[model samples]
Target chain A: MMSDNSDIDKYYDVVVVGAGPAGIGVGILLQKLGINHIILEKTSIGESFRKWPIETRFISPSFTGNFFKMPDLNAITPDTSPAFTLLTEHPTGEDYVEYLENLAKYYDLPIKTEVCVDTVQKKADSFVLTTNKGEYKSTYVIWAAGEYQYPKTNAFEGTHLCTHYSEVDSFSDLEGDEHIVIGAYESGFDAMVSLIRARKVVTLLDDGDYLNLVKSDSSYSLAPFTRDRIEYVADLFDYYTETKVTSVEFVNDTYLVKTANGQTFTSPQKPINCTGFASSLTLVKESFEFKNDYPLLNDFDESTKTSNLFLVGPQVKHKNALFCFIYKYRQRFAIVAEKIAKRMKVPSQAIEKAIQGYKDNNFYLTDLSCCDDECTC
Target chain B: MMSDNSDIDKYYDVVVVGAGPAGIGVGILLQKLGINHIILEKTSIGESFRKWPIETRFISPSFTGNFFKMPDLNAITPDTSPAFTLLTEHPTGEDYVEYLENLAKYYDLPIKTEVCVDTVQKKADSFVLTTNKGEYKSTYVIWAAGEYQYPKTNAFEGTHLCTHYSEVDSFSDLEGDEHIVIGAYESGFDAMVSLIRARKVVTLLDDGDYLNLVKSDSSYSLAPFTRDRIEYVADLFDYYTETKVTSVEFVNDTYLVKTANGQTFTSPQKPINCTGFASSLTLVKESFEFKNDYPLLNDFDESTKTSNLFLVGPQVKHKNALFCFIYKYRQRFAIVAEKIAKRMKVPSQAIEKAIQGYKDNNFYLTDLSCCDDECTC
Candidate 1:
């Protein structure tokens, strides 16, 4: 480890790294209590959501997406639509990005959008953060940098033929003669559908059978107009049409995927990879001592390694269950935000109010403006 | 009111009415335990669903629709798609009906469809259900007959100008005319959209300004495809778009509508209405004393007005919240079915297994065949 030039002169009430769900969530709680805090992000806010495929909508409804301490959407506006209506209409990735942006603007959260923290070393009573911009010294530090930042590629024979899930954002980008998407996760299935829609000959490889873990009230298959053009060769041939791609090799400038059944499928459409993302915690590894490579958090919110340092979002899932997707992110964010605010000695009412508004079970949809025929705006 | 028919002798394990969500849910549960029961429906199974307009789909997703005491969907078949996938694919009224049918067949529940009960009279120890088919006796009656059966037409002058939601199943039946949909409830909005899509001038009426609910995850406005065809003129523009029909008096050659707003609008198309629906429980009022003209039940499973009689489906919503809808019915049915099965002393490991599965939060999607690729049976 390099010698640390840690700054102990300035101390913040709290320092949160990564302006994604967890960081912003804590920032929201602190702002609600009128507490001074700083949020450092390596990129723009909700960069992961921004990178999501255009057609990718939230798997769960908006009822689970509210931030704590805000007014219940229904209480705010009970006329236009209800929680159920809004939830049924799946919000796309762009919609979420817009929602997060609006939320950040609404709270006027204290955030440093482009600051990348390089190290986080704990002093006697505080954490010292060394960033590309400068040093951020705080009494409490929350390492909320999410887990999807790192792209994990296995040492396969043709590893270069695949791309990360983050790279493929739209169907139009999937243009080639034939393509093979690796991984059997939701991302892989999503990519398969997208590639098929783009009219690309596609082969999906998986070590395990892909499962579609969706829930509904009834069995209705609602296909969008965009999806109407795509056709699955095996419609309703069980949940997922099972197939196996064993290996990928180049044949006549085209990638040929060999299946375990001795079937060779050729695809020229630049083989896009849909494998899931991994945690990018290497940057602060030297500074922060992790328990079994984890932030040492207890339950969902408490960070054991550092007193003030907390972890939320997909990063926390690294230590426990992989529950960092959009549906689970907001709910978990609210929990961590409340815990962090309480630990910082913020007023209980403010945090409580935020939690009340943001907690699960209750959902609302509110229109910002009261529109009358006389006044269009 | 006629004299009480307490002298009748009718005994059954349970008599469930209205073959909608609640009725079918309970029926499936009873079937799992080999309980001898009869599910009574005045119309077809899921009759209200069948009556729904072609464009209507469930607001809730499918994952929440499973009845208790059933195998987790994953345990049954991994090929089964989650409720959301099916619902999002082609959301239509018939799609849900088909799912219900599949579930009913899978369980082979004892259900007598199209047996409308005219009255239910409590006897000394059981209940007698006088239906169009025949008089049946039961120890318990669950009222699952849902709301939307009785049309609650507003007592407005020239009421003939409006139509109930149930009758307006298709826009093709609507003739040429500038139409005004009366309420802003779900049905009212649905009608307005349908009329507007049919290229008719449409106006929505609300006592208060319509509340702006939360936006859908996909878009901020109404469902994208549905919103595109319809034009929503808010009440503020009432002066500009008020082609009101004061009196729907018809002449020999054509029908004329006199507008109260000093504008007479006449179209070759008859004005359509979408006020709302009342519960179909009115038929049993003479037979049983009701509180608030609604049966006071132990939370929604109208399994007994007396004994051996159950009212399931939309009618239950009349007495309570409209929970007989797909998402909540299965849960309610599980309770009633378990009680009845226990009363009948049916030997059932399936019910016990299902309860455990539910307690574990293991959803139906997880109930799949263990066989991956080789297990064909």
Candidate 2:
């Protein structure tokens, strides 16, 4: 029943890193399971969502579908919906932060904010987490630090010369008449729409024709929200599809955006990189194996190399099913919690009840193969 | 696999009236269940959706939540997502109509457009549907003719003097300097937002403080989307809470709106009524027994008074659960299909397979009690 870190023992049963949806989801379950765990947050809960561009909103819409076994698309837990809490469908960053804060308060989850985890080292039977606040010891560690903080700096050369889309507070604040935006994903299109709305001329460079692609998975396709926004501002921007940006260079107060097609564009503003994000697993790179720059996890989301160590959040991938969306990854919260609980020998009846609840609510998914089918209708 | 009514049999297992989500959904199941049935549309598939105000969008957010048993909120079927098909989170009426058209084509569900049902009478266990196009004989009938076409005109006196919100094709087209909007629900808020955006001075009268009311059920409260829109335009409108308009009188040029609170408001533009819609069930009132204005139905959604006649769509309420949203009413599609398929004596194996498919996807809800609980989080 306790969520606040009070009257605590020196050692904890588990320590979940990051207080975003993934960590909060795991922390909520662990608390419900009567497992003593402390959530270590580097900044605050939903900090990633808070850092989203000023005009940024969740492409996934939120509805109070909880009673119908469909947890709100953006909700981390089963009983909550950001739409109901924030009164918004596509919640802005601040709105989402409010939802996360409310969830944390409701569950009384033990989250220690402004406590940065510097490193994790396995010592004997327990893992030691050295944070800026203090050292923490736990039997199991759930790494849910997420990928927003770690932009893909190494994805392209001279990435530092350009501003990452995440760095821009608001497109309206950009001090330029003409801007050259590199990348055509959601963020890229978002930047385009906002800039156009603010009356700024933009040259949007796309690596691929992402606008026309309609893949079964939303991860591969531009979200419907983004598509609708693009449609509203498409005529206002100079779009170059099937063109990839290789690098950017500053020359005489202008960014020279070079592309894979051997073309270059000059912009008064630094070229924005909407390329994507790098896995925060670099924090514990040597501990687990990586494939395609992502952590390799077993069916239970447990690290392939590190036993009792679990991974959650947007970076999670099994073959092709990107557990990036809340609805997709929320399923694993129960599975991972069950695995950790079983390892700790938590009561069988409690485990069954909790897991069954998750299963009955459609919040538990064990199979990944079924996630590949396209909509027949 | 055929959709057009050209090759239809002289007698059908069931005849579904309306080609919107409800009827199209049931028709898809009937086609899959191997039952000979056809969907009759007064105009075309999703015509009501197409007829919605140009500024209107679905309050529900659409996500491809099918794998987790939560299909897109606006999807007619389990596998489809309006967000994925139309590429928009809150699709406009036109966008939704396109989605319905695509689904009908994909499923090849027999749908005859412009075939308006003038009268439906049951005779000796067979329902004879007399439409403008022709007469059809069916063993069972499903009335999916939604409520959009039947706006509640009798709720207030002098309603015809005021423009029902549904009558306005687009708020931008309204030629007005000042306007008085009646009702403060989703449509009222929507009209206010659109008119405000178009630079009109609006006076929105609310019978209650509906803006502050946050009910767990979306039916009672203003939609999250509407809330977000109101947040952006709240300052633009002159809001009058606890004001119920008893009547509207056009005195010469201006509209003098009379309220129960004894406050009168003058607007150059006619007041827009957002009081809500009347159930289309009154068209066949002699058949189904009514409870609190809604049709009383069995678990199967078949009429309590009329045998072999089914009811689907927003009007099909069971206790407190208003099956108004596609997600709610869609559950009964399989149940009704199974019941009719059983009576038609389609093999038990076929019925079981189809019904089990619905159950597995979380689309079949026989129990309404589970939907009453609010999210504790």
Candidate 2 ranges with C-alpha deviation above 4 Å: A1-9, A355-357, B1-9, B267-269, B355-357
Give the CAPRI class of candidate 1.
Answer: incorrect
Scored on chain A only, each candidate's TM-score is: 0.72, 0.96
For model 1, residues B183-237, the per-residue Cα lDDT tens digits are: 5545656677666556667655543323343342211223323332233433322
Q: After superposition, how far is residue A179 of candidate 1 from its true place, in Å?
A: 7.1
Candidate 2 residue-wise lDDT, B61-168, digit = tens: 776666656688888777888888777778899989888888888888888888888889999978888877678989989999999988888867889988888888
RMSD to true structure for each model, in Å: 11.5, 2.6
Which 10-residue window of candidate 2 chain B scores lowest in summed lDDT? B1-10
lDDT of 1 by residue, A1-377 (tens): 01233322356877878776566655776676676677777888878767888867554333311111111121111111223233333456665555556556767776676677777888888778887777888877767787766776652446566566777767656555456676656566666666666666666666554343222211111222213222343351112235555566777877775666676666665555555565667765654357665555565455554566566665553323333443334445556666667776777887777666444222211111211111000
Candidate 2 CAPRI category? medium
i-RMSD of model 2 (Å, 1 decimal): 1.6
Among the numbered candidates, top lDDT falls to 2
- Reference contacts recovered by each candidate, as fractions? 0.09, 0.60
- Report residue A245 deviation for candidate 1 (angstroms): 7.4
